[model samples]
Target: MPDRAPQPVDRQLPTDEARDLISLVRDIAQHEIAQKAAEEEDAGRFPREVFTLMSRSGLLGLPYDSEYGGGDQPYEVYLQVLEELAAARLTVGLGLSVHTLAAYGLAAYGTKEQQTEHLPAMLGGGLLGAYALSEPASGSDAASLRTKAVRDGDDWVITGTKAWITHGGIADFYTVMARTGAEGPRGITAFLVPGDAEGLSAAAPEKKMGLKGSPTAQIHLDGVRVSDDRRLGEEGQGFAIALSALDSGRLGIAACAVGLAQAALDEAVAYATDRQQFGRPIADFQGLRFMLADMATQIEAGRALYLAAARLRDAGRPFARQAAMAKLFCTDTAMKVTTDAVQVLGGYGYTADFPAERYMREAKVLQIVEGTNQIQRMVIARHVAGPETR
Candidate 1:
């Protein structure tokens, strides 16, 4: 089956420029991305060329500083672009989000010299990046990570394995966190490591149910050395940096989840209206109508939540709680909506002939990545209830 083009999302943009940007993104998604998305994803083929084109077109670095070869769009605008792309293909949308996350440390916390040196190429010069934070032993309890980065005269030697790293093998740069002192979050430090650094290796890609076009694998940093200049923020600040990136990254994930849900809703509606049963279209059934209505409502709610969080970020205000809530709600909505889309199609949806099954499988991952929905609840509760006292 041919890949379905992303239906336009009715966006409430802040400016004419934002509207034009969304229009451009929709054009690209319809012509370039959606057309090849299904086939490429089915083949588990990574579209490096698409990313290169995005880099050249300045779409890869929206929401970063303009001086650093970035588009300088606000987070709200940038996120809607992500939503459109995700509706076209989850791999492309989520890959771009990870790249943006990988650049967060250098953009937000790097020294002037480091920003001038690396941010430009990283943001738009055809270079891809990955963030390395979750270790094999520390998925949810990230503060308990075991990766170590020991100071060696004028350099740091990094050794440990990072798990579930997107773009693990193909990334050109990695923003890595490692233990530098005592146990726990305070001891963590961040480093910028080149993917080709000596002793850095990526294990085989995971055979995942969805987003297979994107490589998820274990990254081994065995005695990988980087000069002191490559360190991101101050020593013992890696966990904080990681958290900051994730707050923003959660919004990206929320946007992707909303887009995926929207796509499923659109597919369901199209199929329901076109496919007839009992001498009438399924869309005429009140039960199916309620399901579609709920799906659309959830998608709209998730989109609004992510946009609200993005606006808060744009205003330099506190938004962590909102970001966490958006991630939790939007991802869960995606899982629900995609599941309903499969049911709307019945047996036909269970097969690979339709994209509903793929959307369902893809939606499952959004709940797990960035942070598990359970972890997102903990984050939200921490903000809502304050840190629990002994």
Candidate 2:
């Protein structure tokens, strides 16, 4: 049976403008993204043009200030837009999330002159971005990263390797964190390096189980130099900036998880209603019906949790705990729900002919990115029960 169009989510948008924005996003997702998702992913093709279109449409800077060519929308609205795009394609959604994260250091900490000169192009001028924090030896222990930047006359020469960088080779710029002083987090500083910098290069993209359309690679900064003006915040401040960005970036991951789960649920439901057993639709079976119910409940709950966190951020409240909780819950939900979705389709779900298997593979990454679920638990525990004795 032919697949049916997935139903639109009923969202409680704060304003008419937000509602229209979602509607526009849905239209773009359905027409431009969803149709190509499966095919491109299968071929491991990144949709660079789609990102350019998003940049042109102002989707690239939804939560930033309008003064610098951003949409100036609140986090609540921005995250929902992420959810919608993710429902269509995770590469696009998570790519945008990584882009926002890459832009965070400068947007939140750069000098006024830096913002005026670079923010406009970064936000809306068709430039893509990557964040550089993780390294070959330091993934979760980001503070232990070995990348180093040395101050020259008027430039900082950075030398190191960054691993698992999204859009690694293709990005127009990178927000890099490197050691500049004593060891640990206090030694780190952030710099914005242009992709075309003479010494910047990327290794081949990783061969991943899913989200193949999104490039992940090792970015090499062999004496890559940038003017001192590209430094974000003061020296010894990059770790704090990275943490602040992750607090929000976690919410983005949460939203993407929910959207991926929603897509899986939608696929399962459509298949169940059409496939027959004992001359009746498989969806009518009590066991299968219960599974669908649980999947739907989890997706809805995940959506609500992420949105709540987003609202806290929008209101300027302390939401790091909530964000951690949301990321932990939503990603777990995605993994479970997508797995259940595959079970619903029985034999067919295991095959590449359907997207259930793809969804399952994609769902696994959410639990690992933007701070692993294990890290999320640690973050939450630190907030709730206080830091562990060491």
Candidate 3:
């Protein structure tokens, strides 16, 4: 089936420029991205050209400083852009989010010299990035990561493996976290490692249920040497950097979830109205109509939740708890809405001939990525009920 134009979203944009930005994104998404999304996703082919076009069009660096070639748009605006892109292709929307997360360590923690040297190229020069923090043995307990970095003269030698890395093998640069001091959060330090560094290699990409077009692989750093100049922050501060990035990254994930759910709802609505049953549209049935209303409501609520968190983040206040809530609520909404969409489509939804199943599969990972929904609950509970004491 040919991909149709996305259903228009009544966005509450902050400014006239923001409105223009969303319109431009919709144009690119409908004309360039949505048309090929299904074909490329089914073929498991990465649309690198699309990313390059977005880079040139100034979409990749929307939330960062324009002094370094970013769009300088607020998180609210940037996230809405992600929503539009994700409705077209999850790989592209989520890829940009990961890239932004990868850039966060350096952009926020690095010295002036480092920012001046790297941010421009990373933001606008079409250089792709990857974040390397998750290890095979340390998924939830990220601070326990065994990736080691030891000081050797003016350089640091990095050795260990990073698993489930998005854009692992293809990134131009990596924002890597490695143990530098003791075996705890304070021991970790972040580094900006060149992709072509010696002794760095990637394993084969994982075969995934969805978002097959995006590569997820394990990266091995076998005594790869990095200079002190590339360190992101003070030694023993990588965990803090990672957490900070994730707060914003969660918002990105939330926005993407809302987008996916919106797409599924749009699909279901289109199908319900057009697919006739007993000479009347299924949309006339109260049960199906209620389901559609609930889906739309959930999508809107998810969108509002993420935007509220983004506003808090932009205002520079305490928003970790809110971010966690947004992640949990938005992703859960995506899962439910997509599944209901399949249900609305009946047997046809389960088939590859329709994109409903793909949306459901993709939504599964949103609950798992950035931080699992279970982890988000933990985070929120800490804020509300205090940290658990064993």
Candidate 4:
């Protein structure tokens, strides 16, 4: 397992369940995912084999209904699994989380027929999914999206661009947000666009600072036509659905952030104890030990926050603000922990010879993606401001 402290029994979840999931994820991480993480990351290659193995192990659908090939696990259980995967490798964890977010639209809003038609493949991981919300002109302010989908007889012609899409070129389907009514948020609609559809092509992958193994691209919809059957919810409900999906998606990012922080802390601790300086291990130095202590403390706190928010969700309570708080706190902690991890390794940390450098690079994207830390602060501020200001 990760170098994380024991799960407090009083935490907002069943201790045994959390332990079981942690064990399962740890098994996958150590024996399977961890070995190839560094290699594929260096080669800038996606771990399709790892993803396939996860799918076979039923890790892909951790929190969905069993009727549709899902695990029927609670969100609390699901997030821990995500945490473990991320500790092993950020790319796979983030990809799986995004895939689950994309699946939410279909699971939550799709019609019975639509769910029946698509849920099996989606939950089974036979079809990889991506979400298309951010546009070149509109990112954090997603309501300003300009992507258009005009109705024409039995089909809708979708034409616009979606930016910073995870799994853009690789996914079999995309959950796309496009404008269908008049201008502004009220006009937007969501559609399930197949990769094989005409006029739907992804631009070459963006060269990123990290998570390079997970493809990120700009998706172009040039007069792509789709039947109304693919529509998720009513025409103008896209923004709401998107926001709702983000609530859960933020938890996934929070889990990933926590995992990344834990990995950094573990690596730093190991290196500190092993690398000797002045004929003694540097871990014995009070200064370095203090930094390790802080990293471990922050990770544990972040984990608690995210787990609390997840339990709130599982209990059917209002947790949007809490989720945002966890996302913001956890991601920021990841950046700090990973940066210090590099510091722990000193010269070695700066080079590719160690995982600390890669962790530092990967930590940056966690702060930027999934509703940047700035946006997360705004989200939290709204809660403090109350509904009148909101």
Cα deviation at 46, candidate 1, in Å, is 0.9
Model 3, residue pairs in steric clash:
none
Give me the overall lDDT of model 3: 0.94
Q: Comparing 2 and 4 by TM-score, which wins?
A: 2
| Candidate lDDT (C-alpha), each | 0.94, 0.93, 0.94, 0.88
TM-scores of the candidates are: 0.99, 0.99, 0.99, 0.95
lDDT of 2 by residue, 255-360 (tens): 9999899999999998999998899999999999999999999998988899899989999999999999999999999999999999999999999888899999
lDDT per residue, candidate 3, 338-383, as tens digits?
A: 9999999999999988899999999999999988999999999999
- Which of 2 and 3 is the better model by TM-score? 3
lDDT of 4 by residue, 265-339 (tens): 888888899999999999999999999999989998999999999989999999999999999999999999999
Clashing pairs in 4: none
lDDT tens digits by residue: candidate 1, 1-390? 766899887788989988988998898889888998888999999999989988988898999999999888999999999999999999999999999999999999999999999999998899999999998889989999999999999999999999999999999999999999999899999999998999999999999999989999999998999999999999999999999999999999999999999989999999999999999999999999999999999998898899999999999999999999999999999999999999999999998888999999999999999889999998888888888688
Clashes of 3: 0
Q: Which stretches of candidate 4 lie over 4 Å from their true place?
A: 1-20, 387-390
Cα RMSD for predicted model 1: 0.9
lDDT minimum window of 10 residues, candidate 4: 1-10
